[model samples]
Target: MKKRFCIASLLLLCLTSPWIAVAQTVILESPVRVVTSSDRSIFPESWLSPDINAEAEVLQESQIEPSRRVLYKVMKKYPGHILARNLETIYVLHRLKYKGISASGTNSRRNVYVVNRGSRERYTDAWIERTFHAEFSSKLLRNFPQYLDNDVWKKANVESFKYGVSGVKSVKQKKALKMFDPSLHAEGFLYAYAKSTLENDFNSIAEQLFLGDSRFWSVVNKHQRIKEKTDLVIAFYHKIDPKFSRSFFVSLAEVESAEIG
Candidate 1:
């Protein structure tokens, strides 16, 4: 009985040793929450370091902008944090928006339709290959943020603009048509509209653009049968250049032909 009790105690100590080690390591990463004298919670405990808690408290007591500054400062302290990873994603998307027309159809208006498809395999792989960083743990952080960034997610778009006139030939246009979804054609048009009229460039006003009785389905439906349709409302100013107008119909026709074949 004495021998058995000694062995049992030894086993418990062995099992707990690793846990205690892990706990000690975790304390190095754990942050403390600071409550300001003014009754404000300066920063959540989960996001800050024990050393920074006092700084957060001081910032809060001084009535400074706590949330934004905390995020910025915390990133400075623990640049490898998951929050820093997400912030990098945000920064990348913002950079890509000005690059124009994502291959993933980000700002191109096909976003709503693309969501219906079960697989985002192509887009996911593209992001993982191009934008994957060591810090992001959640798949949601990588994928959905592409949609939110407008059209900065597309590779073909970058290629098209780089090649310019050389890339606008028939063969290239046909390939471009394939990347586009039939349902999102109107959103593309609306995007162009928003660009030409409001800001002389594309910007998302998703709320106003998507309003209507059919919930913006009418806008999408209008482009369903271009041959039967007499007039098109392209761009924001409705400036219908007959030449540019033909490009829209021709592109859709190529898509239909490709689908049939």
Candidate 2:
């Protein structure tokens, strides 16, 4: 009875108050949440620059393979030289002699990387040091099986596969076929030179220089073979760039050994 009387009194008060006739109102609002690292962004947004956007548009229109796009970008960075340009021109003229593409001016040198699947490249710098190795060397090694047994990495790789640690399932199929000869040669160089490096996490200068030679297949797992290839590469570098001495690589290895010790 008392509760009903209180409610009645409140209603009566409201009805009697002149301020109530002014139209009472109530408003509700949600509180904003504070975001931190725990709050993830919906999208990764990059700064929109006009030049970058234009290049991206061109690449999108070309519809080339990832390898071709990478090759084109690499070729574009190669410094223009009279020898490289002239040699490329002469080669192109001879190749297209039947088609009358003259040997004058800038021939297909600049556009060599732009060839279709038929005019595939015989060599690329990526065979040495690329952004993605597993994709660059080892992937090609798979398609080219003949080189698989020749690398210093061969024994370890086979052991890994046998133990099921390499994560490669097609060991049997890979052993059965040969790949392009150049791939075999390059892969052989990598695995051989890979053994001769500064005892650090990074690749040594010697390893990088060794890759310049294509006939690194002469290198076997034997200690003397690795030294022979190593010496030849160092000599070539000496002829081209006088600053690079054998001691340069030796000192780097010594420094790495001391640091680790």
Candidate 3:
């Protein structure tokens, strides 16, 4: 009887081992990695150009975990394969600058950089998350411009309206990048900085879409121009991946609001 019981116990363990291993693997896996400036490989080769003058500070030890949590929350919304193929690393720093100008965040080939909240800075987790989405969307836009119909995007804007030369110039001028202005909604723009360029406009919409900002949906529902542009943005994303459907974003917003509530 004792020998028979021991054999049964060993068989049970063998039968469940693979299931336990899968559970452990699922718990350990993360879509992307959050790194600091200490990892020299995070810097892009373009920064080496004399004209770039890019500078960054290493993140404080206390800031690392919070930054990771925020990034993980944002990245987990996408499919793992999408993340692996596009973004792999997030570099969190105390500060970032280029050409001697301060920047809240920026992206290189496959890595994105964001500034940690400082004593004097107004940076918040929401802001950081939005920056991550905005910068990453820029990379996606560049990688797959064919899906972004410039003619369709331009038509959605006000007739005969012209965009500013560059978003960089708008940032350099100290414009409020994220402020929501009702006055701009009729023009199919969500914020002042979006009017700076087509890419910035797309980035603004992309950030709001991915962040699942309720206010953005409110505006989209009330204004025809904003709704039109929003549809274009949704179509652009859906074209890139079928997973980015309207229902997915609607559900994402509900989930975000529930977490906040």
The CA lDDT of each predicted structure is: 0.26, 0.28, 0.79
Per-prediction TM-score to the true structure, in the order listed: 0.18, 0.23, 0.84
lDDT digits (tens) for residues 1-261 of candidate 1: 999999999888856552222211111121322111211122234323443221111112222222223323323322243233233211111111112222221211111001101113333322221122111212322333332232332221223332223212322344333222444343343332221221111222222221111223344445532211112222321231233243443454455357556
Q: Model 1: number of clashes?
A: 8
Give the best candidate by TM-score: 3
What shift in Å separates residue 227 of candidate 2 from its native position after superposition?
1.6
| Lowest-sum lDDT 10-residue window in model 1 | 109-118
Which candidate tops lDDT? 3
Backbone clashes in model 2, listed as residue pairs = 144-179
Clashing pairs in 3: none
lDDT value, residue 75 of candidate 1: 30
Error of 3 at 133 (Å): 0.4
- Cα deviation in Å at residue 67, candidate 3? 0.5
How far in Å is the alpha carbon of 113 misplaced in model 3?
1.2
lDDT of model 1, residue 87: 32
